[model samples]
Target: MIEIDALTKVYGQAQAPAVDEVSLRVPAGSVFGFLGPNGAGKTTTIKMLAGLLTPTSGEVRLGGFDVARQRPAAMAQFGAVLEGSRNVYWSLSAWQNLMYFGRLKGLRKARVAERARDLLTGLGLWDRRDDKVGGFSRGMQQKVAIAAALIADPPIVLLDEPTLGLDVEATRTVKNWITEQSRELGTTVLLTTHQLDVAQELCDRVAVMRRGRLVADLPTRELLAGFRERDRYEIRVEGTVPPGFEAVTREGVTTISVRVSDPGEVYEVVARLRAHGAVLESLTQVQPDLEDVFLALVNEPSHAA
Candidate 1:
């Protein structure tokens, strides 16, 4: 539902572009994660996609409509929750705020009320439907902001750090809602999150960005495979060690450390140990995780260069 071609955004007075020649495509029913560190042009890219900021160069198409040339048509097909959750008026109750935006989106009074009630109930905000948003906590305000975005039932949802300040329980609620919307309603979601674990759990595919450039784009499985490390096999042996193995003396006992490429290697190492008549005490493998990959990519001097 979304296509970006060579999207570049350069802020005036800045030495370089905030978003540099980035191109991406988000399909109709996929959860696409946009990842980057702070000031890495993630928010700038989202703003350009939302038509809130015109790109210095390139094109952004939303559901067959160019965001810059045909803003009304492009925007009509999408809903968004930007950087902050301050869209609703403080004086109005949650229901009223949704009702107001619903009408503005061209929904009938009855439909607006119905959607407002359903979303509020779905988000567990129905109990405080009559409460002023200003009196609510940050989490509550975020829920209201989400409800406002969903009132129109747009096909594409753009969430920029949806769970930024929410607690664990609240974050889970929002995550569940996002999953349901994409799975049940077939809505296309463009999610931007700093939490790699969240993205790994929720996104079908993730694209890592650094320094305004696309560094890695892969399925979660494939991405995980890239960071998967060889297993470590530790064997404790008695007496003099075999010729090929190096042993370290700890408490007057010799312990050997070997790097096993896979399970088959572990089996071979154990068999060799038996042949040499060395006492084997323990063996274990440590596998790399997503955090390792994230750190490697972000820290690589080549990526920054």
Candidate 2:
């Protein structure tokens, strides 16, 4: 649904580009995550693809329409909530905001009312649909903004920090809604957020950026699995342990840590410990998670921005 090739953005006469020769592809009906720290060019890349900013070089295509060359066609292919509640009007009610944006997106007038009704009801804002947006809470306004973005029922959704500051319930609501978009509705999603857990949950594939460069891109599972320290293990034992797996005694219990080169070595180590009179209490393999993977990748000296 989305394709970017050699995309770059540079300030006038700057030594380094804000987005440097970045390229990526997002398959139809898939959720793609964009992750990076401050000044890593995530926003710049999104803006370029959304046609909010002109790229210095290269191309951005959405749903097969060249974003720069075919502006209207590209515009019609996606809906966006890049700035959260700011996308909606303060004076407009939820229903009114949807109608206005529906018109702006060139959606048919008849479809606008139908889509607005469905979106408002789906987002739990039907009861408050008539109330002015300025009177709503941030979370409510955000829901309304998201509703407006989907009012046209575009094929692709570009969301930046879709669930940034909402409370637990509200965040869950948005997360489920994004999931529903790809599953039931077959809509493609391009998501960017600082929340690693959210990305881990919703993204099918993710790309990491550093200093405007695309550093990593892979399926969510593969990316996390790649960061796992497979051979690391923690063992609780009594008596004695093998030479390399030296036991440390604390609180009348002996604990040892070992990092083997291969998985089969774990069994060999266990056999050696048993032969050496070690009495094992527990053996636990260290598990890796998204937070650990994200921190390790982002903090890696070469990937740091």
Candidate 3:
């Protein structure tokens, strides 16, 4: 749904570009996560793609329309929730905010009102729809912000840390709604977030950025598998140490860790320990997660901005 090629951006006369030659693609009906540390240019890239900031050099195309060439048409293809959820009028009611954006999207008065109510209710803001946004809490304002984004029901949604500052319940609500939007509505989501857990849970694929460059792009599972540290085992025993396996004791000698290549090696090690009159308690396998891969890629000294 979106394609960015050789995208570069610089602010004023900065020594280095905020976004440097970053290219990305978001396929239709898929969720793509943009990962980076603070000031790594994730927001700059998103802004270029959203046509909010013009690129110094490079091309940004949204749904086949060149973002710089056809700004209006390109923007019409995307809905973005960027930093600061104050995009809506503070004095306007929640429903009023949605209605305003709906009209801005060129919807008729009746259609705008109907869609605003549906979206507000879906986001659990219908009960408070009449309250002024200036009086609503941050989480409530975020819900209304999301409603405003969906007012036009654009095919692509760019969410920058949608659940950044919410409580567990509010985060859950937003996550579930985003999932529903992707699954049932087939909305293509391109999100930039520092929350690795949220990215792991929601993104089909993730691209990690550093120093204004695209460092790694991989499927969440494949990335995790690549970071697997041989496979770890937990053994419980009381007697002597195993012969072939190197064991590290923890938890008051009730637990030990053994790193092995395969389960058969684990079994062999367990048998060796049992030969010394050690009782076997339980065994478990460890798998690497997105955090492991993210750290591995982003911690490189060469990636410094």
Candidate 4:
């Protein structure tokens, strides 16, 4: 459980805040995506939540403990893997890294050992547990860092770009692990990433930010459905496309996509194509995805201060 209230962060003498009155409530055991393009203050917000940075105004609470006032108790509620930073000791073995972090969390040696075995095995690093993390591949190093983060068995996790540079297989492995943690272990996840498809697939809810302000926040399916309600269609024809229409040709067929304000306009498009002696192949409704929604939101004129 995470709660943010009117969180604001202004740097130095900058006229505008990096994060402005951003508020959110992330439910327990849910995967929530915090999305935005570069310089949208996503990392700034996450840092404040992780206590790595203090907010200029407003508050953050973790599991009902105010992050600023109850730093130790609030920190006990979550583990974090920050972006563009090494979360684990490079010279330490994977097992050693976990053991060290677990002990730091006040876990007993025996308990830490047990958790290390399970986490390393689950992450496919058991065989290399004794190898120095500096010698491991980037993906393996990332896995070690994640294991260390989870070594404490905290109820919540803050992951920023957890899959940034991994290969397809490594990315899938991490995604599956995140899913399992939320579904089976009841772990709350606050994820921030540039990968829209990954967020669309894994996030239960999503919030988009622009110019340090919250633009859209909703359940992923509901957001997609809202865009799907628009009247858009894709038509494939076997002959020449008439004027006033843009077409893409593949093989011998031309595809034209159009959006109409009224459903009756679709029939008019069909009639026009027929008038040009074009043989209709197939017609289907166009579906909008997360990328489309993201671009539309981020490109809009900013009204925030």
- For each candidate, the alpha-carbon lDDT, in order, equals 0.85, 0.89, 0.84, 0.92
RMSD in angstroms, all models?
4.6, 3.4, 3.0, 1.7
The alpha-carbon lDDT assigned to residue 146 of candidate 4 equals 87
Model 4 misplacement above 4 A: 302-305
- Please report the candidate that would top TM-score against the real structure: 4
- Model 2, 44-103: lDDT tens digits are 999999998999999999999999899999888989998533889989899889999999
> Each prediction's TM-score against the native?
0.84, 0.87, 0.89, 0.96
Given candidate 4, what's the lDDT at residue 272? 97
lDDT tens digits by residue: candidate 4, 1-305: 99999999999999999999999999999999999999999989999999989999999999999999999999889898888999999988999999999999989999999999999999999999999999999899888888988998999899889999999999999999999999999999999999999999999999999989998889999878876846889999998989889789999999999889998999999999999999999998887889988887799774222
Q: What is the lDDT of candidate 1?
A: 0.85
lDDT tens readout by residue for model 1, 1-305: 89999999889888889999999988898899888788778988999999889899999999989998898888888888887648678899999999999998889999999999999999999999999999998888888998998899988999888898999988999999999999999999999988878888899877878888878777767877766665665677666666888679777577887886667887887778778877767665545555667777777857431
List clashing residue pairs in candidate 3.
Answer: none
How well does candidate 1 score on lDDT at residue 226?
69
Better of 2 and 3 by lDDT: 2
The RMSD (Cα, Å) of candidate 4 is 1.7
Off by over 4 Å in 3: 236-253, 261-268, 301-305
Q: Which 10 residues in a row give candidate 1 its minimum summed lDDT?
A: 283-292
212: Cα error in model 1, Å: 0.7
* Residue pairs in collision within model 4: none
